[model samples]
Target: MTVIAFLGAIGPLVFIHELGHYFAGRLFGIKSDVFSIGFGREITGWTDRRGTRWKIAWLPLGGYVKFAGDMNAVGEPDAAWLALPAADRARTFQAKPLWQRAIVVAAGPVVNLALAVLILAGFAYGYGVDRTPAIVDSVIAGGPGAAAGLRQGDRILSIDGRSIDSFSELARFAQIRPAEQVAVTINRGGHRFVRPLTIGVERQRDRFGNEYRIGRIGIASGSPVLAPVGLLEAPIAGVRMTGGIIRGTFDTLGQVISGRRSIEELGGPIRIAKISGEQLSLGWAAFVWLVAMLSINLGFINLLPVPMLDGGHLFFYAIEAVRRRPLEPRVQEWAFRGGLAAVLALMLVVTFNDLGAVGLWQRLAGLIG
Candidate 1:
């Protein structure tokens, strides 16, 4: 089930991302080499009448669109188009205006944002988000909140003085908060009790690096109340949710860089898979939330300024815009190599952590002992 959901969620999402680049390239009159759905060797594919080789690669993890002149950028041959005259080179990606190139580069991540909005709007239209009260569930034993004396049936009023009139508000605060002391207000029975919580670092890992965080009480959100507004309002709410998530992601990154956090707190595909598995076991409502949350993550990560990513390409475009031409091919080549190395290192690290998250590490430790 997890496998199914993960593939269903990622495949269409990636197709949309690559389609953005492909369509934008066409709009700018840039020739595309291929429109691929996955990486590595082709599985099933057909070349378009325009000579673009559309194929699904063996690796199902990610996809990309190759542009003409991409081969030349790396000093490779145009063997596939050897029949074309040298005069036709203007159709290559390099021949496009700097602004057009920038637009093409920027479209990939923009499509991701659009997909997230659409998905969220779908959920909002069919099953609108309820303004659920921030009701407390059970606390994990020995966890930070338990250590702070939080109990069941407590209705949280605020966190660090941020008013939490709804579960969404509470979560809005929680999403960005790392390991830090926080003040809380909860209505216990009929009386409101204020308490302070000092969160200890909880570490996680991803395909990039370790990350750390902190949170107060464990929570099982009460159902959202019908906050019914209007039919046209769902899209607005979806876009707002995407923006809020992006802001929170940036805030978390800032916290991590400031040494208030650690890298071991990151969670990658393995963690997500587990969560997806568990969520499926529960019900569709949980699954929908997971999709929305993961959509936000996808949108944010693609926009990160790492080389080989959409944002990185956009960054290069910005440079070209100022300089009036692309950077030296050699410079772009070296940058891409370094970016690939970084991505690989992060992937290996996260994979190891993923195995450990499934108790592979601890079981090995016990065996050695």
Candidate 2:
């Protein structure tokens, strides 16, 4: 069931990402030689009328679209193919303008982002969001809220100058910044005032014995309400939600890079499979929500400025646009090799983390002892 769930969730995303590149190439009249659903040995395939060999390969990790006049899936120009007649060259990816090539390389990640936004928008339009005012009914004695002079009937207006509409939003903001001081804006008798509030922290452990630190302000909710969003507002809400996720991801990565967070928090395919199966057991809603979040992550990761990635291709294109020529072939090749090494190292680290998460390393150590 776990295997099936993982495949079901990941397969379509890979296909869609490759399809984006294929369509973009077609749009510019560039012909594709192969459209593969995976890398390596072909399990099965068929040639279309346009002579593109569509195939499913043995590995299900990732896929690619191989365009004409290219050396391989990486889209480097093949010397022999480049030497073909002008008529043939005109229909190849390498024959296109730098701007066109940039668009083709960028289309994959953009489609993933669009897919995430549409999924979130559909959920908003179909079910709507829960809404409640950030009104304080009571404050816990000796807690952060009481220490900050928060009292009953005071309405929380914002946190750190960012306006919040509901108690849920306020909680979310505070939860991420445990032990940090933030400016709390409150509305009392229609007049607003800001106060410096140090959020109280609590240590929590999950069923898996994973510990987490969360913030508390010690305020109780007054009332709760469900708000139905209009059709026109749903897409806007989706975009806003996507933007927030992106920003949060950046923040987390920044912390990890700065040594303020542990890199063990990262996971790979094994972790994704476990989570996908868990979400499937919960219900389709939870599963699809996971998909939407993963889609956003997929899009964001692909846009990072690293070689052997779509973003790397775009980076080269940007340099080409500036210099009026592409980099030397040998230099580009070495950069791609370095990029591949970096990507593989990251995969190894994440896989090790995933194994540790599942207690595999501990079990192995027990046997060794």
Candidate 3:
């Protein structure tokens, strides 16, 4: 079940992402030599009339589109391929204008983001927004809400001047603003007033042993209510949801980099596979929602200015635009090597964390003991 769910979830994402780059390259007359859905040995493949080898590889961690004249999947320029005849060179990726190449490089992540937005929009259209009012049922003593004069039966009106329609909205708003002071408005006894409070920090551990630090305001909600979304409003809701996810991701990463959050919170392929299976057990809707979130994360990660990624190519193109020529091949090679090392180190760390989350280390120790 785990393997099946993981493949089902990641297969479409990888294919769609590579297709984005493929189509964008085709638009500018650049030919792709390979369109692979994985990194390693080919499990099965076929060559198309256009001469592109479409394949499913053994390693399912990621995929790539290798354009003609590129040294590898990262799109590094190949000197030998560059020396091809004029007609052959014309259809190669390196032969295109710098702007065109940049677009082709960026198309993958952009398409991933677009996919997330479309999925979220479809969900909003089918189901509605959460309409549970932000009514406080209880407030824990000595907590942030209690300290701020909040009490039972108080209805939250807004936070930081933004209207809060549901308890979920209020909770989400507070969760992202951990330990930060915010003005929250509430109505009690038919009178409304604004109260400033510093949201408390809470460290929580999930059943999978993954830890997270989130904001806690010391209040609980009654129950959830669903409200139907209008056709016209669904797209807007989707865009807003995607934007929120992007912002939250940035905030979490910033905290991780700053040492405010534990690095154990970062998970790699193993954790994703486990969660994918769990969500699949819950039902298709939950699984698809998880997929949308992962899509957003995929797009954001690829856009970072790290070498060997789409953003890296764009970064190089930006420099070429300024200097009117590409960087020296030797320098680019060294930079790519460093980028590969950094990426590999991160992967190892995340994998270690995932193993720990699953209690692999403990099991090993028990056997040795």
Candidate 4:
């Protein structure tokens, strides 16, 4: 079951991710030679009338598309591809308009996000949702919650005197009320604590020089019972879920970047398998959350400006857009090799860490005895 689920999760997620790039490339009128859902020798395949060979490969760990003049099966341009005639190279990726190339590069992550949103919506509609009522899990140390006189285990009764029956409402109040002082009412123990507190919101900068806003209440809470809202309500919940997951992901990334967290905390495939296994035991709701969380991670990771990644491709596109020409093919190839090496090293490290997290090394230790 664990193996099945781990395979299932990665297979579909990867397919959808790559499909985004493939479809978007075609949408912009780029030609493709192959659109495979997995790697290695073909298990089953069909040639479209247009000569695109679609296949399900044996090694299903990941999949990719072969664009016209793709230097590699993964759709990257190669040196030999550069030797092709200019007319032949027109169908090549490097020949595409800068904007079209960027869209093709960006679409994979975008599709992952879209799949997550839809998954969330469907999950919410099927199983209902859990929301936290205006509840204080704990007061932040000198943070807004603490400054507002919130107490330990206090259920946030209201914020700014607005009646909030749900934590969603309280959270909305928190996000939009950035840097504003508000009266917070909480039930601590058997007593109520009310304090006027000035709340502070955190700010983050993005790749495009855009900024994002977030509430800075340093605490956690139990999810309230979200009785099944109507079908219409689930989509809203899903959208909110997507946004919240993205926000939390960015916060964690920021922490990692700012040295507030250790890189050792990062996990790779082993961690994902363990998590998927655990979620399988917990049932579908847990499974869906795992999918959404991983989907976000997939989206974010692909958007990273690494040379062999979607983000890396986009970075080149950005450079090309500025320079009015693509990087020299040799330069791009060398950059890709360096990036691939870095990626492999990172993978080994994360896999080791993940194995440690799951006590696999320890288990093997016991086996050695």
On TM-score, the candidate that comes out on top is: 2
Q: Ranking by lDDT, best first?
A: 3, 2, 4, 1
Q: Is candidate 1 or candidate 4 better by TM-score?
A: 1
TM-score of each prediction? 0.76, 0.90, 0.89, 0.73
Q: Least accurate stretch of 10 residues (summed lDDT) in model 1?
A: 72-81
Off by over 4 Å in 4: 40-44, 79-88, 126-149, 152-236, 364-369
Q: CA lDDT, every prediction?
A: 0.74, 0.86, 0.90, 0.77
State the lDDT of candidate 4 residue by residue for 240-308, as single tens digits. Answer: 778777766775677677775567777887778876877877787778778877887899888889988
lDDT of 3 at 176: 64
Each prediction's RMSD over C-alphas, in Å, is 6.1, 2.5, 3.0, 8.7
Tens digit per residue, CA lDDT, model 3, 1-369: 888999998989989988999999999999889999999999999999999999999999999999999999888889977689999899999889998999998999999999998899899889887778899999999999999999999999998888887898788878866898889999999999999999999988875555677899999888778778888898888888898789779978997899866788789999999989888988999999999998999889999988898898899999999999999999999989988999999999999998987789989999999
Provide the clashing-pair count of each candidate structure: 13, 0, 0, 4
Q: What TM-score number comes out for model 1? A: 0.76
Over the full model, what C-alpha lDDT does candidate 1 score relative to the true structure? 0.74
Give per-residue CA lDDT, model 1, range 76-168, as digits (tens).
Answer: 224455455665676777666777877887787788788778777777777776678788766778876787778888888887776777777
Off by over 4 Å in 1: 72-87, 129-167, 175-179, 182-214, 217-225
Q: 283-359, model 2: which lDDT tens digit per residue?
A: 89989988888888888898888988898889888898899998988888888888899999999999999999778
**Candidate with the greatest lDDT versus the true structure:** 3
* Candidate 2: residue 333 Cα off by (Å): 1.8
